[model samples]
Target: MKKIVLIIALLSPLFTYAQNKPNKKKGPTTYDLLIGTYTSGTSKGIAVYRFYAENGRLAYLSQIDGVTNPSYLTLSSNNKFIYAVNETPKGEVSSFSFEPKTGKISFINKQSSEGDDPCYVGVDKAQKNVFVANYSSGTVAVLPVNKDGSLSKAIQTLHDDGAHGPNKDRQEGPHAHMSILSPDEKYLLYNDLGTDKVNVLRYRASNEKPLEPASTPFVSVKPGDGPRHLEFSADKKHAYLITEMGSNVLVFDYDNGKLKQKQTITLLADNFKGQTAGAALHLSPDGRFLYASNRLETNEIIVYAVNQETGELTFVQRQPSMGKNPRDFAIDPTGKFMIVANQNSDTIYVLRIDNATGKLSPTGSRLEIGNPVCLKFAPAQ
Candidate 1:
């Protein structure tokens, strides 16, 4: 009996110590938040904040100025560099070297977009090339990335050759909205809103002029859909597209740079006839749910459950973004929260994501900035 008591006493302290030890999970608790804005309003340039994963919150850390109308941002695969499109009458693409630890960016250089009103920017995984979608000019331009993180003159420029979309007001000319890379980075999806087409371009990172038309060429959406952002599934088996004028989503079965239409889902109610312009679409971190944002009269985010096997999207929930003009929103790496960037409201709302049902609830967390059109996340210590 005494021996048993002694053994229990010895093990009690060890058990208590083990229980009190901190969790050693491999997930990061915080990430660096990079925000791009139109300098015409309250913002002067790009902004950075530390995003807390445990609780949905943001702490301002650093910012850099002098770059005008940084309406969109894309970070390198390594997160060491950032490229932004200067959305101006005279379009330009700017480059910056990023310090993730400090959330600080140093201006590198800039180059003409070879077209007007550059809006979307994308960088290759090898960090060798930068692609910009000149929105007004309806052209896609590619520039080489220098060793020092600067941007060289455009090497290749391709114009969208198609008749204007049906919408005479917004589709008078070709507008390349976004440039999204394939999951394997073998192809580039050029989304032209004015032409209502997603052009597939072969991406050869090692070549001087990398973007050539793919074998499949392009995928045409509804005449007035105004295709905007397109996101690929993590497995590369499916793709989702958001249409601005149509206020709907189109699903595609993706195989080797070829996309076959599968399902089409509308983000609107049966009789709701208010003005709406879809802006951004992104899959959840787990790829189990897809979220699309819209602006104008309907300022809300629509959540849909992704059918894993079929790549079909079923409506899950639709919630107001709690502000106006929710242009871009990002899901955190932990999959616990989503921050909606409302451009006209100058507010970004952090909403709690329901993991089980893919519903979003207000967390009472918000950040106010001027003309925040883009939000991006990167790893931080």
Candidate 2:
């Protein structure tokens, strides 16, 4: 008995040391927020804001100006620059040198989008080229991004052809609503709302050109679906798309660089009647949830739980957006909070997210801006 007791005491400190060595778990870090805009007619400037997320709180760090209707934006891989679309009649794209610490933007240069009413922009993985989707003109344009963070002249612009819908007011012309680069950066996907199709173009970063017929062809949504925005799963094996006019979501089996329609689901109640459209769609960074924004009647965000194995989406919950007309919204870098830009209400609504359940609650911290059109987030620290 004495010998056993002696051995137990000898090994106790070793066991405690092994258990106490700080379990290698990573914690959260400070995140910075970026803001996109649709500045009112009175102000020619769109802006970006930096918010610090620390200790369960956010603080407006700084703001920058001198942009034109920056409705959507994307950051460079190196985090040194930003590219934004000027959603205006003239339709141009602007590049900037982003000072993350100060949230100050220095205009590098602006290049014509080569089409009218450019609404969305994305950068290729190589960081050498930029793609712009012109909504009104129904075209996609590619441009070169200089090493200095300026934009060169547009290299290529391809006009989409076709229009189909019962509503004459909305489908009279092709409207290229959004552009996204593939994971391999070899293809650019442009979804046209007016035609209810998603066009795939072979993108060449080195040549700063998009292959004609775009090579990959296009995917058709259900008649009158009016696909607005889409997001791919982390593995690039599946995609989720939101139809603006139909107010439905579709899942696709993506393989060999092509998208095949798989399932379609509605986010609305069967008996609920409302005149509205869907605007934006995104997959949560963690890949556990998906979110889509609705406009017009309810002006709320619809959440869906994603099945990782099958790529099917299940209706989770609907949360009222604190503002009206949520034209665009973004999940913060940390995925802890969401900020919505209400175009009609001219306010920015912030929501606290429940990670376990994927529900939302209003934070009541509304930032007033004129004709706020979109919200984006950047890094804080």
Candidate 3:
């Protein structure tokens, strides 16, 4: 009996030690993904998903319906509200209160976009103003965001009238594609694809008519380049413009709301002659790399090594987007993965980004939704 008792006592400590061992498996770090889609098809409205940053996987969550073509989405600085553009003949901008914990959203109130077919939406850093680019109407409207996160009536509307681009079918008139706020929130810049120019305006929250033309009102690109999107470097010293018609990226030196052309690079191979359209442009969090996506023919992402000192770009590698017609894509806050919204393919592809070389590799995970047009990530609550 003594021998058996001694043996049991020795094993008890071992059993306790095994029971107290730390877990080797770690829980996933999650982020809230908001997808904007075209409502012409089966898609009702914005779809929400939970993205597992640890492994580049997404779990579908609930969605908010009844919105017509919430084609583009932007989140408030506080991450407590979301704003979307109702792309319709009679355009509208809707606001919603976002619950990150539950991945659910509740409709607040919507206001007229002051134009037709609004395509893009952006919120100021102060969260006091919301901006919409009316693509069909060739106007940009500034709407005040109420304290409760709803949108008030548009306070000011700026009409852009200019010479049309060379492409008569697509660029017959001013088509404002995107409206973005400068890093300091002191200026607003918008691209007019039809006019092939970027309009810069000074923004003041306290003023009655907040948006005024900047000293350098506009920067004109090549006649038919069709500047679609603009992305500023982390230092705010450089800007990159993605041209839809030409399928190229243009580099610019930015200073005090003025842009000077630096360089232009093609997004395709020298010998590959096919229809190409540049869609989206994004810079890595570290500002070491730049990524731009080409739709239609190529359906690939053009990677570039950014010269931090001079803001010049050197071609890196082009990787397939893994789906068709990548209209928009976003890099997660951690910069570990990129999610591409393939509008025509009805899918979203997850690609792992190599931090060392800025190259992309497929993670083999995809989300199926009807005509996913825009992707936005909010930190998990």
Best by lDDT: 3
What is the C-alpha lDDT profile of model 2 across 1-381, one tens digit per residue?
Answer: 999999999999999999888767644355556667776653455555555444335566555566878888888887788888898888999988887667776778899998888888988756788888998899888888787988989878887656555568887888998888877776778888888888887766665355555545898988787889888899888988888899999999987558889899986767869888888887777888999999889788999999989999899889887778888888865667888888887788778888888888887777777777766666643
| lDDT score for candidate 3 against the true structure | 0.93
Candidate 1 lDDT over 1-381, as tens digits, reads 999999999999999999998889768879999999999988999999999999988999999988899999999988899999999999999999999999989998899999999999998888888899998899999999988889999999999776688889889879998888898889999989998899999999988788899999999998999999999998889999999889999999999899999899998877998999989998888999999998898899999999989999999898999999999999999999999999999999999999899999999999999998999999995
lDDT of 3 by residue, 141-249 (tens): 9999989999999999998766688889999999999999888888999999999999999998999999999999999999988999999999999999999999989
State the displacement of the C-alpha of residue 26, model 2, in Å, after optimal TM-score superposition.
Answer: 3.5
Over all chains combined, what TM-score does candidate 1 have?
A: 0.94
lDDT of 2 at 306: 90
The numbered model that scores best in TM-score is 1
Candidate 3: stretches off by over 4 Å: 1-28
After best superposition, candidate 2 residue 41: deviation in angstroms? 5.4
TM-score of each: 0.94, 0.90, 0.92
How many clashes in each structure? Answer: 0, 7, 0
lDDT of 3 at 106: 97
How close to the true structure is residue 54 of candidate 3, measured as C-alpha lDDT? 88
Which regions of candidate 1 deviate over 4 angstroms? Answer: 1-25
In model 1, state the lDDT of residue 315.
Answer: 95
